[model samples]
Target: MEIDDLTPAETRVWRAFATGTPVDFRATDDEDPSDGGAWGAERTVRAHVLRALLLDGPRAEGEVPALNLAGVRVTGVLELQYATVDHPLRLRHCHFEDVPRLYGARLREVNLSESVLPGLISHAVRVEGVLRLTRARFAGMVRLGGAEVTGSLYLESTRIQAPDTEGPVLQLNQAVLGADLWAPGLVARGEVRLDGARVAGTVNLTDAVLDRPGGTALKAETLAAESDVLLRDAEVLGRLELRGARIPGRLDLSHARLANPGGTALRASSCVIGELWLRQGPMVEGVLNLRRTQVDVLFLEPEVVPAWVQLNDLTYTSLIPHEPAERRLPMLEKGDSYLPFVYEQLTASYRRIGDDDAARSVQLAKQRRYRRTLPWYGRLWGHLQDVTVGYGFRPLRAGGWLLSLLAVGSAAYGLHHPPPLKPAESPDFNPVFYTLDLLLPVISFGQENAFAPEGGYQTLAYVLIITGWILATTVIAGLTRTVSRQ
Candidate 1:
């Protein structure tokens, strides 16, 4: 592995490293560059081995030019396990033509800036310091399972290609990230799985476009974080599942487009956050399932009125729901009761969009579904009373008395004139006499003879008159008592 005894290609690689010059390797037909004479075609192989060894050792104290490992495709695994370089290890403008394996490699402080890694497998890799990969592109699968990164993981302006079998483009299961996981302007053409990953800081995916038509764009479970999971302005072409993810701060999904047609579940079950907002978006398909998800402040912003169709047990300032527009208004009005406030703030929302009817229907359906929830007395007696009061049977009873009064008046008027007889042919032809003879008797006994003839009707007339008088007197007495109490 000495420099002088190395081949011409190896000498070239060694010269490049010594002079701090960029090493460029030409692409060959064979997958393994070592198999052909291509090994000597690029640079010193001994220098690469030396550089790898130095990276695994302690960092040099003085400032030096960043080690550029650009475009040197390794035939076998690029083993840089336990690397602790002080100077930023630059892999700028490099291309990994084949799948590169870097298992257990410790990148203390590295910058893979603007690199193209088509296929990469860095399982159990520990990044102690910052790992900046700004403007990098991944054409194939990238796995980083069980990785522990203390510093910020930057992936700005990166593009990850889709997998062949509708799998995730980037998988980071069981990884412990300390600083912010920033992926601004990053685009993923496949699913991005971070299941069981713990982020200490914010997991920002702002302005990122994720296209996963066959599956979910982001799937993270038990993702506990202090700061907000900011997905603001991020576009997901498929489902975004955050099942069992807990955030101490807000889960901001505002101004984001999430379109998943396969009935994909956007579950955030058992999650605890300050707020979970999906507002400010024009469209969001699939259910925004939040079963058992707890939020300190649930903001339904005014501009997001039509975004949500249904909600369940989402606690807010009030247990009642509010119209997005009216939520900002004062809760109390002049001389208004709390019931009206609750009704207006909560029930009015459903009533405005006709959802109240649907909610009532759902409640009724639930009553039928879980009949045992109610006691027998409540189900039978209380429910029947509710129906009766709702239909206003008391008002119908009042109308019955009015109908009877009108019937007695009409019958008595008919009996006095007999249709064929005229006023001029009447016996006395006097109005006062007619009034005393006809009107007084009719008023007194009209209830009995109102619908019958002379003899038998007279007997019935006395009974009906007495009964009618008694009913009228009782009604008047009840009204008096009610008025006195008031």
Candidate 2:
């Protein structure tokens, strides 16, 4: 298309545009010039007229006046497919009748801020400077697949509508971004994909809203970021998938709200990060799946603890739980009582930090939870043993019980002074030796069978024998439980 193919209004636009001057078409605060209303002296044009003028452009690089179509209503598709241009394009406050197609195009910089468009398709496109879509509105999908941006992608205050629910509103798969994805205040009606995207800087989605029930709102699989990924204060109505992603810096989701009832709210399996902070006022209404995710540090707040957390096989070096906040057990739908591995993961984590005491405490907590799931008879037996011996976990308690039995038996036998039960060269009433002979299994210290107890004293010896059996059984149980865990 040539400039000659343009209409009268378009002719005027071409004259000024081809001469490197801007053309404005906005009315004054009043009615018109007849009603003493003011206006700019620049010529007005329809979207098609300007469309032809843009296509027939200043034939080469460093073309006419930045294509500054500010405040103009474009009545057609701004198709710039497969074109290579070095000039800047600014479409601030413009209203497009259709989506702009920049497929396979190369541009220095482009700005479409404060505009309203159906959407934007720029597959395989490359831009040297920032593509500013701040405060813009997209009524359809914005596809930037395979695009390379030397600078940042600014989507701050932008609203994208994708009513299909399962479809993505923004597609940046495999895109290489040199700078940040600055998207604060973004309202995406569907998913925002970042699969295999390499972001050289932070992905700041602060205060962003993405709603797609039972589906992923953010699919950032294998995303490698040079800096942090912040979702602070954002609200996601579906899943936030970051499977296999690598973030050298922290992944902060502070104050974020996520909900995907009966499904995963966050799945970051195999993700590697410096730190993960899910603290502040964050609320997750579904499973928080972090299976096999490795992080240097993890920080969580009690207020943000979800009832259903899925941290199976998750590994972290240090944990910084906010005051009175413990790792909310893999609060599964049925609770984590049946899943001892969840507690074991936590125990192992504590052990990794050389905190054996904390590890033992976690193990005890696990036992207590499992104890509740047992049958009545099993529970009774478990309680009986736990109270006196910790169900084979508290060896010190067993030792104390054993010592009590020894002391009681020694004192009673000393007072009773039993006679010899069998033939012996020397029959002496040594309470210490007598108690040891009865307590130890299969050991003959000659004080037990050699001594004969009189009527009531025989009852005391039987009591001592039963106590020894109980103590020995408890000691073996404790040792077995401890060794089995290792």
Candidate 3:
């Protein structure tokens, strides 16, 4: 277009683009555009005019061409689909008439910080430099699926509210980021999906607020992050699904609030994480699932313990705080379903930390949980084993039981002696020897075979024999199980 064909605002923007100078329409940097009545023709730029200047613009001999305009009202859709523009685009604090479509567009540094737009579609686009949307407000969806960003993608203090839309408000699914995905203080009214996203650097969403009640707040399933995925101090009013995600660094959600009552609050099942920190008393109002999640170090403090959890097949090498089993056992009991492996894993974890007594306590708790699933007869037998030996976790209990039974039997028989069946064959009728002979099922003292008790004394002798067999059998089974575990 000729110079005479351009308007005053267009002429200034075109002239500044050649020298890479930023044109600020606002009176001051902090000037509120909404407070003004309207944007006049001098502050308005057509999207097609901006596109034309970006695609083919005259530049000074030693200057790089760029379209840096601030506080301008961009009219019409900025359609640069499948276009390759090498110039840096900085449209800070600009107001857009429609969502800019950059589908499959390759660009350099693009900063739309503090802009007010309906939406942005940059799917399959490649950005060589950073893409900043800091403090930007989007009233609709922002789709960046399958995009590649060499530098970090910053969304600091960005707010996206798509209340009428059922789809994700901010979709970054399957995107590959060479650097970090920094989105601290982001507020999304709908779902924010990062499914299958691979980030070379950290995925930080600290202080973000995601509100998609009864639906997914953040869905990052199968996401692979080289560095930590920090969601610290986030407020999620829906499900935070991170199933099958693999993070080499920590996945810290400390001090976050996850509320999806009667539904899953945070499901990280099948995840492989280096350090999974859910400490600092995060409020989880729903089921916290860690089923099949494998973490190297899990920092789960007592204050953050959820009432309902799914811990089946969850494996953690080290538990932080290293608290006693008494404190951690309540966490294992939160699951509704009986999972023996969870108990075994907890027991192993305690043992690894050289807390043998705590480990034994976990084992005892495991037996108690297992007993609830058995039939009446099986439960009866379990009670016997538990009372007498503490399921072999407390070996001293077995000795105490043995000593008590011995004293009871010796006292009962010492009051009255049974008449000897063969007076000449039997040795002196000793009450202690007679009691030992009846109590010890395998060992015989020769007194039981020689003496024949009648009436109530005979019935007491039968009770002693049966009780001896039960104690001997239970002790052997418990000892064998304990030894095998060791």
Candidate 4:
């Protein structure tokens, strides 16, 4: 391109690109035209002119090629679809009249920090270097789906208030990043999706404020991250879903406030996480669902326990803090529905930590919950077992019942002796031996069969026999269950 045909600002940018010199159009560092402040023709560069300099520019000898322009107004859409450019594109603190389209373009690096644009569409683009959009503000959708970044993707302190759309406002689905996704202090007014995205390093979103109520705020289902996904101190007003995710490092949500009342605040169902730390206490206003999820270590010490949870089939190897069964049992009680497997999982977790008493309590609670689903007669039987033996968890209660019944039987029989079954043939009858014979159905002292009781004494004898049989049967059933579990 001839320099004679170029505008003053365009000529300056073209000459600077050949030697990789940055062009700053602002008269002062405080001058920011990003708020729609008009810039004169001397501070404007046509997109076609910039494109020509990027694709067909004449470079100086031994000088690198770069389009580094600042505080300039970019006119028209800078379409670079399927184009291969080796230069770095830096348009910092600039204003764009239209969204730049880089669909399927291959570039070295791109930095649009501190700029204001309607949106950006770089779908399927490949960047060998980092892609930085720090402090940039967008008013429409930012699509980067299927993009592969060799270096990190930075969105630090950026504000994106996207127009209403069917898809997420910031779409990065299926994108693969070589390094971390550093987006601390991000403020997105719409949904941010990372579905199927794979990050080699961590995905940090600390202090972010995502406000897309009645919908998913950050949907990262099946997101595989090598390091941690930190959302510490974030405030997400919608659902923060991570279903089917595989995070080798921790998914820390400490001090975060998630609010999606009457809906799922956090849904991590079917995920396989290394460690999930919800400690230092997060406030979840809705249901926290972890159904079918498997985590190596789960640290759940929320500030306020969720009113409802879905923990069916969730398997965690370890639980943090090792609180007693009383504290943890409340979590199971808040389940959406009765899940026997959840109680068993807690029981096993307590047992692994060498808390036998806690394990027993969890098991007993499981039986009580299970009893609610039975018929009236079955529930009545369950109540008997619970009152007598604590559903087999409190085996010592059986001994107490036996001792009390024996005392009652002995006092009644000692008050009035029965006639001998055969005169002069039966041995001398003893009240203690006679009560023992009547109480133990299988074991006899030959006292009950050798004597005869009439009227009220006969009725007392019948009662003792029936009560003894019930106690014996319950004890045997309870013991069998306990042994099998062991």
Listed in order, each prediction's TM-score against the native is 0.61, 0.82, 0.94, 0.93
Q: What overall lDDT, based on C-alpha atoms, would model 2 receive against the true structure?
A: 0.77
lDDT (CA) for every model shown? 0.58, 0.77, 0.90, 0.91
**Cα lDDT for residue 170, candidate 4:** 94
Query: Candidate 3 residues 383-486, lDDT tens each?
Result: 99999888888878877876777788788778887888988788888888888888889999888998899998899889889988887888898999899998
Deviation in Å, model 2, residue 478 alpha carbon: 4.1
Output the number of the lDDT-best candidate: 4
Ranking by lDDT: 4, 3, 2, 1
Model with the higher TM-score, candidate 3 or 4:
3
Index of the highest-TM-score prediction? 3
Which 10 successive residues of model 1 have the least lDDT summed?
330-339
Q: Which runs of model 4 end up more than 4 angstroms from their true locations?
A: 27-33, 302-305, 411-433, 450-458
Q: Give the Cα error of residue 182 in candidate 3, in Å.
A: 0.4
Q: Kindly state the number of residue pairs that clash in model 4.
A: 0
Q: Could you give the candidate ranking by TM-score, starting with the highest? A: 3, 4, 2, 1
Candidates 1 and 3 compared: the better one by TM-score is: 3
**CA error at residue 456 for candidate 3, angstroms:** 3.3
Model 2 misplaced regions, further than 4 Å: 1-44, 58-64, 164-166, 322-345, 351-354, 364-393, 407-417, 422-433, 442-446, 454-460, 473-486
Q: Write the number of the candidate with greater TM-score, choosing between 1 and 2.
A: 2
Candidate 2: give the clashing pairs: 420-452, 421-451, 421-452
**lDDT (C-alpha) at residue 101 in model 3:** 98
